[model samples]
Target: MNFFQFFVWGSWLISLGGYMGNQLGFSGLQIGSVYSTMGIASVFMPGLLGIVADRWVNAERVFALAHFIAAGALIAAAGMTDFASFYTYMLVHSLFYMPTLALSNSVCYNVLTRRNFDVVKTFPPIRVWGTVGFIVAMWAVDLLGWTKSANQLYLAAGAGLFLGCYAFTVPPSPPYLDETRKKSLMSSLGLDAFVLFRKKNIALFFVFSLLLGAALQITNAFGGPFLDDFKTKYPDSFGVKHPNLLLSISQISETLFILLIPFFLTRFGIRNVILFSIVAWVLRFALFGLGNPDDRLYLLILSMIIYGMAFDFFNISGSLYVEKMAEPTIRSSAQGLFMIMTNGFGAIIGSYGSGWVVDHFTDSGGVRDWPNIWFTFAGYALALAVLFLLVFRDRRIEDIKR
Candidate 1:
């Protein structure tokens, strides 16, 4: 289930920029606008759906229905020639698909707790397979020469359709509502999870989540186009020809780093683990600024390797942190809030902001000042890391366990 869930995303998430720019001739701003659909949907859909799962419907059914609809949206998106039409389909797709992210985690947590499995210990290994699935989908697209074609959307659609069907086979996760009890509107809508913000530590953590989330989309939005630009500059380069395969190294590293989450969280606690991620983002962007495919290929590979830590340390561990801290009744809502902060508000900022930066550095001839653009991004990460270190307070894992 985790496998196909991410497989659908991997098919196009990284490579979509190159496809839109190279084939469809989308401007940088237009592409960013399209990607921001994920953010717009994420801001409300996850929380709203979390409420539905918590009070009204089964989570697995919601997951299945969302994917089934998303499959049709992807197929329709593939046939779109105009940006307006494509954006509309993708917007529809994002509305249904973004909610499923929180829903899937909710379903998994429900089943695991029911089976008496420790989530911190067991979920990472299972979730590692999602990265494996992402890698496989990336390789399939690369090997099949679909990176800059609409066929990638077809691949995603097929996977979505399959997962939609498979979702019904998962363990049942019924609503947690009590019929005898009368609930306030906020509680009924799952907005009660917002109360966590009243706590200083939780509030600070979410603020940093928003900051770090900005870094997440920068790479996903531009990495492929960055590598593919080499084809125009140095047509003989391996990086230019195999950009998808090259980018797959990040997913490969993600799989390894995911397995280390249990140890990192237990030993270093949430504060240090997240700090490591912030530091990694600093290196991730700086390396991109300094390296290229020819003589500096090693730096690029190292950058990709560090992506595992940059991504998994914060996102996966943060999800586990939410699972540990929130009450059982509101667990789904808390996870949705996490998604709202990271993928919702943060993604919107990153998408539009990065597009403006790229456009600013672009010349009249359409050549982008890639190194300077990357350096600007690196500076943003470095400043955020410093701010996080100073502002966020640490709480020990022992305290969390108690």
Candidate 2:
């Protein structure tokens, strides 16, 4: 299940930019529409599903159903020959897929608690292996030459099919059928988590979450194609020839740095670690703005290296902070709320906003005005960093009363 959750993402994710731009003959905005489709699902499904899992159904069953739907959606997506059709199927697919990211966690938590496992101590080490699984899936596509082809969709579909069936066999997450059960499914879903927006710190965190998310796909949606373009502009370019392999470096770095997240959050605390993330994000975009496949290889490599710190620092550490801070009754709900902010709303902002900016700058030749676009992104990160420092006070937990 851990493998498929990321494996499905890997298929379309890393290579979609090149496929959309070069093969489907799309402009950047059109490609953005496809990417934006994910935001639509992330918003609705996660909370709704979490509520269902908490109240009426088993989290594992919900996870299986979601994967089944996602598999069918992905397979349908495979048959799409045009952007609009592809986007529609992807939209449906993500509605199911996004929730599973959270549901899988729910299932893991339920099983761990039932078995008396020390989740805080044991889960992180086991979870680190999921990053390994993600890296392996990424390399599978690269080595199999699935990087440039539509077959990547099928690779994901196959995994989804397998997991969908396997989900039922896993340990059951019987619905909250206990004496503690409260209001019907509606309230259990923590639809009330939305009230959290009224809180100053949460509201601030979510605002920055969206702005930072804008940077998330700026690279994923453009990086591979950008490197591959050098292949054409410089036919002798070795970088383009091996772009997938080079891009894989980011995942390798991603896997390694994620292991350091628990430590970073514990030692430096949330504010400084998050500040590090913002600084790293600025450099990430700046490096890509200047990097090339040829002699500037080190810059590209450095960009991928920082991707570890930039992405894992903000996302992983942010989630841990929520886990540490929220009241236990609504603790998991708080994490769900975070996803709605980052993956759901933030994704929508990133996908559409970045596309518009990219479209605004590009010429008739389809060449990206990369430096301007990237610097513009850097400014966004910097602005968010400033806002975070000014407004969100992270008082030492013990000093603040409930």
Candidate 3:
């Protein structure tokens, strides 16, 4: 279930920018607008669907239905030629697809907890397979020469249909609402999870999450396009010929880092783990700024390698922290809140902000100043890292374990 859930995403998430820019000739803001659909959807869908799963419907059923609908949207998106039509289809697709992220985690946690498994220890291994599935999908797209083509959307649609069918076979996870108990309006509407903001620690964590989340989409929205830009600059370069494959190194590194989460979280605790993630983000962007495809190929590979740490340390570790802190009844809602901060608002900022930077650096000749744009992004990440270290209080691992 987790495998194909992410496989569908991987089919296009990393390469879509290149596809739109190189093939369809989308402008920076237009591409960012398209990617921002994920942000807009994340802001509402996860919390809304979580409410249904918690109070009304089975989570597995909701997950399946979302994917089934998303499959049709992907098929529609594949046929779109104009930006407006493509954006509309992608927006619909994202609305249905984003919630499934939290839903999948909720389903896995429920199943694992029901079986008396330790989530901190068990969930990382299971989630690693999702990264593996993502890597496989990336390779498939690149190897088949579909990286800049609509065929990638078709591939995603196929995966979505498969997962939609497979979700029904997963362990049943029904609503956990206690019908006899009187519920407040907030609880009934699933907004009760917002109460966590009243706690100083949780509030600070979420604020930092929003900051970090802004960094998340910068790479995904532009990395492939950045690499593909080399095609024109160095037409004979390996990076240009296989930009998708080159970018797959990031996912490959992600798989390794996902496995290390149990060790990192247990040893360093969430505060330090997240701090390390911020530092890694600094390196990730700086490397991109400094490196090129042919002569500085090692730097590009290094950037890809660091992406694993930057992404896994903050995202997966933060999810685990939320799992530890949230009550069982509202666990899904808490996850939705986390997604809202990171992927929702944060992604929106990163998408629009980075798009503006790209446009700002482009000359009248249509060529972009890639190095300066990357440096600007790196500077943004560095500022966040410094602010996070100064403002957030660190919690010890032993204390959290209790």
User: By TM-score, how accurate is candidate 3?
Assistant: 0.98
Question: Each candidate's lDDT (Cα)?
Answer: 0.88, 0.75, 0.90
Model 1 C-alpha lDDT per residue in residues 192-234, reported as the tens digit of each score: 6898888777888889988888888888988988988777667
C-alpha lDDT (0 to 100) for residue 107 of candidate 3: 96
Q: How does residue 126 of candidate 1 score in lDDT?
A: 88
Model 3 CA deviation exceeding 4 Å by range: 180-182, 398-402
Clashing pairs in model 3, backbone N/Cα/C closer than 3 A: none
Q: After aligning candidate 2 to the native by TM-score, how far in Å is the CA of 366 from where it should be?
A: 1.7
Candidate 1 is scored at a TM of 0.98
**Tens digit per residue, CA lDDT, model 3, 1-402:** 878988999999999999999899998989988998999998989999987887778999999999999999999999998999999999999999999999999999999999999998899999988888898898899999999999999999999999999999999998886853126678766686898888777788899888899899988889988988887668888788888788889989998999999898888888889999999999999999999999999999999999999999999988888878877888788889999999899888888889999999999988989999999999999999899888887677853464
**Clash count, candidate 3:** 0
Question: Cα RMSD for candidate 2?
Answer: 2.5
lDDT measured at residue 128 in model 3 versus the true structure, 0 to 100: 89
Which candidate tops lDDT? 3
